[model samples]
Target chain A: MAEPAYLVASDSETTGEEKSSSPFPDIAIGIDIGTSQCSVAVWSGSQVELVRNTRNQKLMRSYVTFKDEIPAGGVSNQLAHEYEMLSGAAIFNMKRLIGRVDTDPVVHASKSLPFLVQTLNIGVRPFIAALVKNMWRSTTPEEVLAIFLVELRAMAEVQLKRPVRNVVLTIPVSFSRFQITRIERACAMAGLQVLRLMPEPTAVALLYAQQQQQSVHENMGSGSEKIALIFNMGAGFCDVAVTATAGGVSQIKALAGTALGGEDILLNMMRHLLPDMDTHFSTRGIDEIRRMGLLRVATQDAIHKLSSQSSVQIDVDLGNGRKISKALGREEFEDVNWEIFEKCESLIKQCLHDAKVEVEDISDVILVGGCSNIPKLRNIITGVCKREIYNGINPLEAAVRGAALEGAVASGVNDPFGSLDLLTIQATPLSIGVRADGNSFVPIIHQNTTMPVRRDVIFTTVHDNQAEALIIVYEGDEKAMEKNHLLGYFKITGIPPALKGVPEINVCMDIDASNVLRVFAGVVMPGVQNPAGPVMEVRMPTVDDGHGWCAEALNRTYGSTLDLVTVQKKGAH
Target chain B: MYSNGVGHLPRSDPLRFSFLHSTRLENPPQFVSFRIRPGPAIRSSLNDTISERPAMSFYELLGIPETGSLVEIKQAYKQLARKYHPDVSPPGRAEEYTQAFIRVQEAYETLSDPRRRALYDRDMAKGVHLAFTARRRGIFDEQMEEKSEWKSRWQSQLSELKRKSMQKDSDDNMSWGARMRRERNQSS
Candidate 1:
């Protein structure tokens, strides 16, 4: 029940050391929940500890089962190899069912899973079952997630011998806003305070940078010279993120990813081989043959073996008193998984394009993922980009190590890796604009501009005898207000009624260090000597803060009953 | 429900689940009550009659406009309501304030809607009785008159007006104020 392995591994060492110095409350835990497996790691002081399941394995099957009774014999006996058969209740790959409705693409694709998927309508939303086969109870995705997180929280508490409160959960970048909300809600239900949500690829990159900094300190020229690209290809997905160090600051430049990776490649091989066998064998016979998890594992092993070997043979037990064996070569595996390779290639290309860097510009291509160990994948990457791929670190554990490093940085147990001082610039520029007569005014703040920039614009009142003005702010480069999302707006009330152009309102917008915009407005008087007064600072509401600026602006502008008027101002001699 | 656009039956629908009947409670007696209601002292007013009643200073009551700007209208409503809201105001004045606020809200809603505003204006011009029922019926009738030539003509005129304003905005690039500001800044 402790936080997952990948979450705390980087910061574990620091925490272990700190434990001896002072008694610090255990607040942070990390979790890595994968489709086939799940792992938890907890940080105590400077030491990082992992909780192993009964099998002495860090990864859980991601399966849950419900029945009238719990399975007897608290632990499974590996000697009998009867673990799968003696189950009173078992569920597998429940993570896949989390936050997914029946209509979700992933849910539909998962129908082929050997497990049963139950459907239930809860309130206004529908939830899908996560486990294969048994359905004793119906639960929402958030509830399933909460079950996992709660277990993790308990594990951490047991290790620390005290209560743990704060947690950081890693999510895929492709996860939508709705999915993130479900995850957050699950964390809340589990009684763990979610301090922050880190993207999986970002965590992996941080880990890699931290390790690279320690080993190749001399090779890294200066605080600003360290630059590397982290390529994480996991079972469910693959992501590529570019990070650079300049002035001791390390920041993510751009990230590109895809849902298809090593898992799909293995699954596709099964799909092809299984259907072909079905043509020759009975459908039920083939079903029995495919039920064995070992067959899938054998196929994956063969693929992994073929990555290094010129050829490999896979022995298959046909379930009955028959056995068949076939030899597969590297070329054969590549041909079978060409589509998946293409997807990885496209994602890498997108990452490069987003970062505005070419393959030649990349100093190092660090590969992290269990699949990256496949010889064929490494060869393909090397051949395509014509660069030697770095595999010095274990692909499977690299993300965990990196996550721990980030933990150390966040908890202030260790100084951020030397790459932290990178003068990295934004990959995409943010623009601020206003809507006028259905069109937008996009002025200054060009995309990719350095951070901490301020811009100002002046405008006259839209109508005559207008005492108050409403200014709507938006983020994005779209020319229409409808297209761009409105961040928020503020009202400048108590303006004296002047001819349409007589009064001037100066609106100044400043994007601070954290990339959040702050707006201020003031009324500028005409030629008369007037005492200077402080400008009214307006507080912008965040999307997560419950109040939306757009709704407020709509209520202020559209809710108003004033009519438009155009009046000429008296000329001054 | 589907025909009415609510779409599909609820999951708890009795017809969908046969087991629901077993869980249902046994028959219960139904209760009925009857009462006689008194008629109002005043008869229902006609839309034309209300429209014919001289246009009161509803905008002034709301502190907005017969021709107020959008900002002015919003500010006036907020200010007037804050002062006269039943919950916020004195109990003795609550009823009067509530009535005034309701009247202002009704007037604003009518004028804010172009179709309602037009019908009211037409009734006022014709000196016709403006009863709520008649106004509602007239609006519904107007909505149902598809492909009416008069509506199309008015739409075309509105579109032309929009196009002209957009063009004028583009043409007048350097306003006097902007030019003066530039000159003044340079001199300073």
Candidate 2:
């Protein structure tokens, strides 16, 4: 729906009156279901049209307040006053909480919020609830997200004046296949088909690719392709991607992301301003919730002002004779959130190194997302890139806009419009492998490998007369599977009785273009199609609930007697 | 060849000549020749300095200046590596590109590591053959006396590292339970 930018895109710009009829006559919408904010946009015949709610707010607060029998999402229903939002009924930040176990630090962090977040830390889902009329009403993170999506869909349908079903959602690069499944289920619950789930920074890269294609028309310049470093950090996650673009081909060289963002910084600053503040603002009755809301609002506004000015003052009274008055400086703000800034710098460095590019190789540094506007964050990025940033794209809407462009491209819209030819060759952001080498994590497909990729690693039995070998699959960069995210696991039985290091158990991981991961395992003799054992192929991330615990239990029950070591890394050294 | 002027050619480079016994050297000196000039009886890669030089530093392979920043190093490697990446290049030249790509990758691996890069830089800075020079200074020489002590310490560490690596390579095949049992027995 960004007319000015799309105007610079597509061949239709040149053939004006020829295709004025409408660029995208039919298309699915792109939605960025962010942790704190959400937005939806679509290719509207000629250009993208950002759908707005009845309140005319393009960016809807991602929250579902449970008050009446029927809950209300912020997108569908707006509360008249800020105080009403603090009624201890709204469940916000569901994106961070979804698909997480109680032991997760983020779940622990959520315990400080206004609503109830009770945890046993026993690998089960945390208990989340909202206080309504002095009674605690239980809810799951998935339920909260489904309600929000339903509201967002209704708004988009109303604006499009048609039944909106298909959508392309922008997700964090660090999101595991397990997390993707949760997002798909949420979409399914909302009565929508997921045409594609694009990583946030990859979506930005697509937009950059289109821009590069359009710019080719104006400048007969350099003629060389350009490499862009896209750093996107919203309220919930921070993601980085390096892409090479030429003639509409956006080949993603590297991608890196961390589950840390504005919310963590805001929480850090709040704790700094009010020491032992958790004791005062922890989940309680509706009155304490109101106090928590007031303080949060004050802290958020102060942080926003800090971005513009050097300092800001905060004076707010949480009822019950609690008064807080403080003057916060910008340096103090950065000092409080040093880890966030440090991570931002390291992520950029890691992405650059992974892409095998030096700062000089980067033709443009694109900073997007809500956090990109912060002065300190911007300076940190400049320090790493050793150059100024390209801020032509609006920070707030870039991810959604990129997603919208992807929707048009994915819809098979061939064009008199130049944008349709845009293609992005993505890469795996993390390694996918299994536990082998006496519990050492052996990766079959490493991070930064071009997709859709297929690679196999051979493993052998650790003990003599072994029959079955356990293939516990995981995805992450860690050297130990204990530290990585357990995707799924299976036991490959019927290995012909053999001495240690004799059986050839092959484990191959294939990641298709759609980012679907399938792991295949079989015991094979060299050059033989039919092996001594059955070949098992299974889709990953199906290992349900507390996989961290499951990995340990498997090892405890079944010793490493049948464990396998890598055959040999197959690339020429 | 070991250049007295600036950087030495990598010993592994096919273009460089290695140390040979003075008795075996038919020609005295040429564009490149062993300068350590060992007595007819002695033969050692360490005590004798090679006209062979050391392996190429990661920086030299990447074609970036030694003083180049980390970013510059990465950029140089990336651009060159991409030119040789098999996926993008024509398949008919796959063999040629594959070899070149490996070299580019090897260069990047060393240069990108701060610890490894610093180690290489230190070694590069010590371009002179102290061991060769000290040997000629004789046992009674003060400089030789001090160097011998330093040389012994380095030799011991080198042997220790060799032992550790040999153990590690074989340990890769050992199961976790077996390793624990072995450790327990060793402790007992």
Candidate 3:
């Protein structure tokens, strides 16, 4: 009898010996686990080596399809065909689900993407459920990501012939502390130690700066100044960052990113072209187009052609003798995806505004990521920003290369990562204070001050014989604390009862280096010796684990047989 | 709101006016006066309290040149504050350090504000000339009371010391300092 598909193989040979003498692994991996496509790159001792999937492909379509039910013995044998046959069931663009609520605008926007998503109701907790196959079900974004990470890890392990452990994952600049923690936890569950969770634009800027350094050395003797604006247009997001360097200090002056990017533009173009097809046939007739996979292939082809050619004929292979073809020009593509182009332009302008600089101030503009290959996007950014864009390096691979350089720098190896001189960009609310009686927060710390600073406010008791006071902490510039998000609250107790106006209490709010806030209070009595005071400590909230979901997932996947082998080895010893 | 509440206070009791309400007083506390000893004279006001004092000019408090730029003034204040911040220093001395630091900070802030600094510069010109004449005559009004207080206090202390010395001479073999020096030499 065949073992269960979910069962861990008992006699599976563990490859690669643990070498204690080796200081560190020669290879470092950078995994860009994106929504539409997942790409993995491994940096060997020297250059980055792209690891292909089991099917020998550099990138995998982030789609998992499931069958209605298995036919008899099992569905594993028929899963591949079913994946293709029931393409409607295939859930793509999982990145949109990561760290988002069901009511989030991005979740609604994901409807435009070509995929099937199910909303699961688990008690009061509403989560996204993606059916990967008859036997596999992903109920959360982390689980879906774990499946992709596992595949990427296996690919790296096979290619390098060594155990790959350290990885650098890229996240959006706007990711909250909780979101970053969740991604970190998911990576940890997949047996990968995340060295750092770097912002995508920062990684791209580092990569571009590294390339510029190499060119400056090779062509110009030295001392040549170079500044670049990295416009990263990925499948699910677009972000722009301005990087400037003089001497050895590099700074990311500003960054702007949004949830709209290349995939949105393509979908918009698809909607435009598909409706035009309805002129020749009924809307329901497109069902045949979907079944034949012509719609998927045609849409992708048109996007590819638009990158290089002014116009290309999208031919729909009807599988029968009949065929349909339509010519899509650059003008038509721009008209169809004008909204996306406008968003990209607005983000670029926002970045420039935040930096308080002009386009002329930037020496070079580097276009990066797979979506950046779109000619229309490239032209729009260049024309609007009024700077010449550089496409000398592959945008798809730039972030990974930069991540590898970062890994090399972390491992104490000599590399170009240092020459890049990337600056860390952080965005947090400017002012923090507490609420008063009339729903007003007495402003304690003003915004725009470089952090790791503290400010104190002194308040007297309002009522006579009062012993305790509440310090309600809030984030935002709102005058009222109730209007802002209550970060945390602490009560200062054990104060000696005295006349209302006589007792004094000093509340100190300190924002630490990590942008986490801490509150400390001091209470004093009129004539008491060594009056009792209370100190309340509140840490930032981390991602919540709903009763060991990751641990159980790991056990179901890699537990039983491995444990037996370990037991047997111990017995033999 | 205020007119109706005037009669509420008892006539015999002193009606207290907070910093926010009253601008003038029958007699305000002298800010420049300090209790002097043989060592450095310590200011009576706490650091946070000096902000309420209106008599002292900003330039005199910060000890900075009139022509100092904003950056220079800020740097000087930060340096002085780090040196004198109560948290890092000896416990009891913090009150004095905090007072001086706050006065210095207030001076920097006043001078940094364009309008305030302009008014201050004019007032400073007249004040400096008066102070110079007062100093030359050896009749500095600010120091007169302080000097007299120090003199009278020291004289009384001196008499008490003489009486103690006379009593000690009959009983002890050496002076206190001499005996301490001898003990140190023996220990070494």
Candidate 4:
């Protein structure tokens, strides 16, 4: 069956085995699983076309409803009305909560959902469930996402008349290596082998590169460099990227992203509607779940209506003589969600700064995502970029289209018209480093460095005669080690007890074409032709679930005995 | 884009020349070593390129003159990138194309940055040639043990890089005016 084939493909691909030797390589479909909506697109011989489901829906709702013994997903499930999704049986917005620990503020804020999200406030996965048969059925975000992806795969297969195994999924830029592993695991569960995970904004940049290449062809120009700034804000995350395109190659200069999106806006509006909503809905009774569902549906409707209207009248009723009737103006909605908008502005600014691009040099500003329709966000992005939004691509379908283009390219599909002659040189979205110099993060590969890149940093032991040194790798721009995400940790033994700052411990980080990260470390002393010991190459994100407390545990057990500091280089100066 | 195949060997042609030359000097027997095997066609093609050019400057690798501007550099980079990028290249020559593409990218990276370009210019003026960091291939492809052996041959190359960086640090120690004067003198 296709399920077993998927497991074998994923396992081999994860082991970095080359699968391109087959004469007819399978074309990986591109899937954009948005927080609230999802779409599938494939390169169909001549052009990218969205794969519609049996219901002829191009964009399906992203949710999985637990009913009876089997679960139904949005891809094939028929919902009677919008309120049915909010009835506590549906699990949606798994993208935001997939890899987050229970102590995260995002998880804490998710408690107000109609479904049950119980957090112990410890550094562990949150407990989530869906209402079934008047009882709570335990579930996880990964399980719900896998069920949804399985439905998507089945639908695409039925329409395309082929087994869909490989997929290029679009993920947010803010996702850590651990989150990416979770995404890969979900795809594995769905019997899908992930070929690539393109960041949302970078995918848009690829689409823009194609558009620019086409224009250059029409004009018979030299295909000069065109600098474009992409701002993408979806239902669950916001991302920005600066790219330079020429000759069908989009070189990503920098990327910035944050986990702030439309859900936060809806929650804030819900709070405004009923001040005591959290306390009133704290109890997980059936009546409160129904009331919460009503409020969620009402607020979602108002938010959507406010996109085109000046004011939206929101009225909802709860049991026990509780009611909310309020007028939500566009200005009021914008004011309430000012933090989200502010974050969007800062992400664009930070991306521009990191790219070393000036506003005057930006040829086009591309805004593509679900939230691109928000007037306030549009203004903020345009104001910062000082350019009007590029209108050549669809806001919702841009990412999936780009992913389809990437799928074809990575699959080695050749085209006569040169439409497939495209490449996106990606950049590292976050710094991957190790803890050194007394708990400070020392980045071996800094953020915004180009991909297929390898960089190394030399370090020395902090304690004299220290035989072993711990290499606790983290990913972020944080200066303090605790603030960053701990990817994994390893120990370099047999360092040949030398002075505190004598031996050179080389820590190298490499991100290859497929976005696989491997960390190599060895002890290299001056005047030594060979390393002290055999080098160790470890694939990253080696830590498993509930890894949030590993860093604290490492510090507690070893203290400062195995710490390393950056090696100081001396010269004639 | 890149309909012509002229730039396929535009960059790696000259660098591969120096690489084979250094290999011949450092460890000539390694090419025939049983552990390291290249196909006869690859060996012959590599030998042919050895006589093409002995060494290459970053500017020469990109097919641009030393005085090329940032725009010209970017154009050359884009052209070569389109020709040799792994995804765009024909499937039969992905391995060869990827190596050339990395050289072009590295050349563009060093030349596009003003500070790095100046340092490279200084090194070139002082007759300190830049050796290809062969470790990149070894570190990436585990199946290719030849790369690791090739990396050991370039250990002295790393020391050269270290010395160049030390010179750069001493040059950086000067104040803005002094450094500008030194740069002007070097250029002159």
Candidate 5:
């Protein structure tokens, strides 16, 4: 019970190398979690606050319910109405079903989710459930997010009276790296200590780099450069970063996430108001989960009154004789979520074309979460960031207030009028790779690179005494290897036989500065010492959840005899 | 297991959590094995950068000249990023002025950008990246089939352009009176 923030961040790196005893511990905190609301925050000695639960409600509703067998969560249950939160015993989107996989088409469109998801599309882990009182109750999205991070660590250790272990959460830049290893195994099963997961628009560009370092202490010029661009759009991710900041750091420079959001605009307006909503709510009975919890609480109250009215008249009936009368205006709910707002303008034009940032050198175009309150996603992100957007924060507490200002700047918290001397700089939102040429996806850490990095590539063996290889480790940036996102695989097995493209392997990859992810590999062969095998690391993505049919059952139980490739170099990238 | 994709469930307490102290109980849904001490199995790109002669030439790390402008490389990178602003420097010289203020802001972000200072002025006039392999293969068609704009063709491309202009003056550690007036106009 005493993992005291890794014994106070390794005893402040062995006896205070003081910048106020480093490794961040102003009781760190800041959570977010959302795919349907969850909060928490901290640094309260003089700012970032949030933490409200005794139903004073500072967001909550992310879910746990199980109607008694001791389940509860969404921070101390408290769920009273909205059809007992679309009943069938509660369990909400555990952030779009955590580290996904029932052959994930977002877990087969969360099979008309009124809970009890099921999906046996073969690649595994998607049975979910909650339907309690009429029997069904299973669980695991890492035990409903470690039971909502143990009620957000006992409501931030009863409001900072201390001992609430590190944290800083806020993910989704299209997660993957085995959904950040099941959100760090649901924050080490709530004995919490994640210290920094970040990337929800780099925690809103670390709260726009502490609001441009408190507007650079009331306008001091010389340090120019702001750039921003954020655009979050919540309820299960839709990122897009582009940072740049300066002085109080914030780098990022280009992300472009997309597990599209507001749960695909409430499952595309509940399949445009039940056009036989998946054969009348696919069935777990109990009257089709109470007529799919009354048309998902009348389509979440006609999409929250079509965000300040323009026409909404859902009129559901489903008491087992389906009946939906529609009217949903706002240009027919923007023609039923216009391909999720034309995929939020190609994820803000591919994050300003991978941060060669343009839209007139953006300065601010922020827009945080909860589908950044619609108006056709604020006139298509203010007409593709031709600026005028910055809804001045609070789009559902701007990603846990930029993850509680990156939990007071990576917990080395300071700010003697210098605004928490910060430093964000992260990026690599997917593109880790490794699945040789013929199999394809070879990337080796490419996407938006930066982040506590360290790379390595050189691959080889492809047959002839391939002796043994199978390294697997994927994570999307597409281009085959079965369209990316695997994240773990090993099996080196003494390869001294050499030949085919003759050994040399290498691999490496690092990532640390706490976005964890190790990998390693190693193999050699020329004048071989301990090469041809003995070095297999693998910490990534702690692989799980039908790693796409375990990379098709390890390529049908080792097919191309442990393949490997990309050692290409005629001027490599 | 959802029909074999190892989507990791077969749980009933497969030792649920204990990730980072480098758990070596090997394999399960639980992992946190740090390891990584095995350093030298030999590598080279020479111990990856920070102490290599490879850096230094963003116009001599911003002392700026070869036609510097973007307003003199943003006023010489805002006076060397305000004399290396690691929180206004001087607190135990803020990590050696934040690693020379992040290589003087990565040489003022590659010389205040006009297409990354025209590709860092053609990789500082060919210290060998032949215009970065024709700007990363947007094809220079092997720089017009290997150098010669017909300047009296090749004496082996004039000793490979006099050893790439003396390896771009020892990688811009500078000794250039315009490379001694192009080696006395290629020795008259």
Candidate 6:
């Protein structure tokens, strides 16, 4: 039989140049894979359109079930009810577990889920398994995610009637460069090429820009700039961004995010409703899994009800004569999740301070994501911005729609009505630096700096006749190097024999529009334009999985012998 | 990567996508003449222009008067940003547009903050640009003559140090240079 063009998975390494070089331009689709839900959208000629699955549902549950001979994902499978997903055979919430090691507190918190999550706490990947046929079948987060993505790709192909290869996926802003690589790896395994990975709020910002541009044309105005504060809280992450939009270009001024989200609220509520929930679910037997599922469904229902109502009553009976009943009031729920709400407020303030934007100057306040409808979250956002929420966008669909617009714009598509004339100038969400000056993070490119940027800093040897220096790159906002995410490390050698602090080491970091990071280093003596040796240019985030222990190993071996100190004062750029 | 001539620009295009290309000149003849002039003189002249130069004032880059209001500065920045951002620019000239876009952002970054802008203005009045205070670039720029001048200066300085050390050695036969060499050898 001849191979079906739509069914064959293409090579994963095809780049944008190659895609554009082809005769027929391939318009990449936009996908938002949320922690609890997933949606796909594409630019169909003049406007963005969301694609539906076989059941004609736009938003599908994000999970994969391994109950049968062949595993089935939520994309096409017909799930009877919510309880079915909470069963031990289904593995969900991969967004929280993906790219996180066992030592991460987030992974430790996930141990209470119905599925089996085992951690050794040795700075390695956590062990995740699904109960299949009375046996614990081991699997990885990447594998589960890829399986789900494949189903989505098949459904899109069937609907669009073309070979779907490229995609633009929206991710959480707090995800590290290492986490991004894992997402890319999963996409590759699913036989999909990632064109662009946009942070969720930036994607929403792009959509808002398009809307503002249209409004400006309708009014025939001068296209004055409009600043919008975007707060997105989903099941997995919370992100805040400040954007200034004018003439269809949304320039991100600042961004802040954290891993705290709605999932924490659910867990908190569960613990409150059942005080001994941990001890009860500690033993992962089939009966215990079923009982956990029952309580989880009840608590989730109560929380959803608390969004619209003032109070809710949760009543569930676990087998073995365990019965619990309680009333959860809105005020009580707020008290339970007060820490998460406080963090959200602080993130918004930090973003505003970094962007140099005042709350009164904010023209629009956009609330998006799954948890945006919660009354407490809504009040917190409005209180922080001191403005009513903008109702122009749908909270859940905004991210996917913006992603679709980016996909169309980046694919070199054109529209006669000028709707496709849009752009998003992104900023680095975290500071990128090198470990220097006694384990201090000397940032070369500070957070909130615009893209396609190049900044260099000069450093010198800390010891006399030090021939080599280690350039360990990290990405974070922390002052200490250990608190940041280690991207990569290399050594610069062949320095001329000189006194301490005499040999100049020039380290330059460049981030392109597509967000590719490159670090360049060379040794230059005084008054010499020619470096002592050839320059070394390496792409960043070179460390792979299990990199959590790499920094410790380096410290143990090198012992600060190959240290460097900053030669210039502040604001060297 | 440091070829330092026109020949390297096109060859380096694939590796450093936006770096050299954004700074690529439109007129070939003007670029050649610009490169032929002495480095320090041209650099000093460019620095005085307050635009596209290392010491260029933020006001000039945004095309606003030094006394321009914050609103006026923001308006100018937004206008230029629209004109030069790579995504909105014509596809063929995207690289060239990116360079202007970055300069606009840099100007805005400083001028958008009142405290930073005030300090920058003070420094501008003193004729001491912040760009000159730090040792940033290496030999990666495409200026051949500048590199050669730097090399000659370094060679002359090294020779002067050697000459002074030799003279001292001839006078005392136990110069500090000899002592330092002995210490270095022992340490090694």
TM-score of 6: 0.82
The TM-scores, one per candidate, come to: 0.51, 0.73, 0.57, 0.82, 0.33, 0.82
DockQ score of each predicted structure, in the order shown? 0.01, 0.01, 0.01, 0.06, 0.01, 0.06
Report chain B TM per candidate: 0.35, 0.38, 0.37, 0.43, 0.24, 0.42
Q: Once model 5 is optimally superposed onto the true structure by TM-score, how far is the C-alpha of residue A246 displaced, in angstroms?
A: 3.3
Residues A71-182 of candidate 4 have per-residue lDDT tens digits of 9999999999877887889888999899888877888888888888998865789999999978899999999999999999999888887777778899999999999999
Best by lDDT: 6
User: Tens digit of lDDT per residue, candidate 3, span A128-185?
Assistant: 4433332234356666566557667777777667777667777765454445556766
CA deviation > 4 Å runs, candidate 1: A1-22, A42-56, A67-97, A118-127, A130-136, A215-224, A246-248, A276-298, A308-326, A414-573, B1-188
Candidate 1: what lDDT?
Answer: 0.49
State each candidate's clash count.
Answer: 62, 11, 2, 0, 8, 0
- Per residue, candidate 5 scores C-alpha lDDT tens digits across A1-573 of 245344224223122232233223345678988878888887765678898878788887787887886887777877567688777788788778787777778877877777787877766788887887788868878888888788888887776655665677888887776777777777877767565678778887877777777877788765666788888888777888888776667777779787878877877887777766788667557777777778777887788788888997788778645588878788887887888889888888988997887788788888878877778888888888877888668778888977887766555555567666666767788778677654455566668866445456667787787777788878876533455777778877777775788777877776643356677777777565555435666666766676667776666566556778755544523
Candidates in order have lDDT scores of: 0.49, 0.70, 0.51, 0.76, 0.67, 0.78
lDDT of 2 by residue, B121-156 (tens): 665688722322322222113223333443455356
Model 1 Cα lDDT, one tens digit per residue, A343-382: 7777677666766567776766778766777776676667
- Model 6 residue runs over 4 Å out of place are A1-25, A568-573, B1-69, B88-97, B114-188
Worst 10 residues of 3 chain A by lDDT: A561-570
User: After TM-score superposition, what is the CA distance of residue A228 in candidate 2 from its true location, in Å?
Assistant: 0.8
lDDT (tens digit, per residue) of candidate 5 on B34-60: 112223321331122123334356666
Ranking by TM-score: 4, 6, 2, 3, 1, 5
Error of model 6, residue A465, in angstroms: 1.9
What lDDT score goes with residue A133 in model 5? 70
Interface RMSD of the candidates, in order: 29.7, 27.8, 37.5, 19.4, 20.0, 16.9
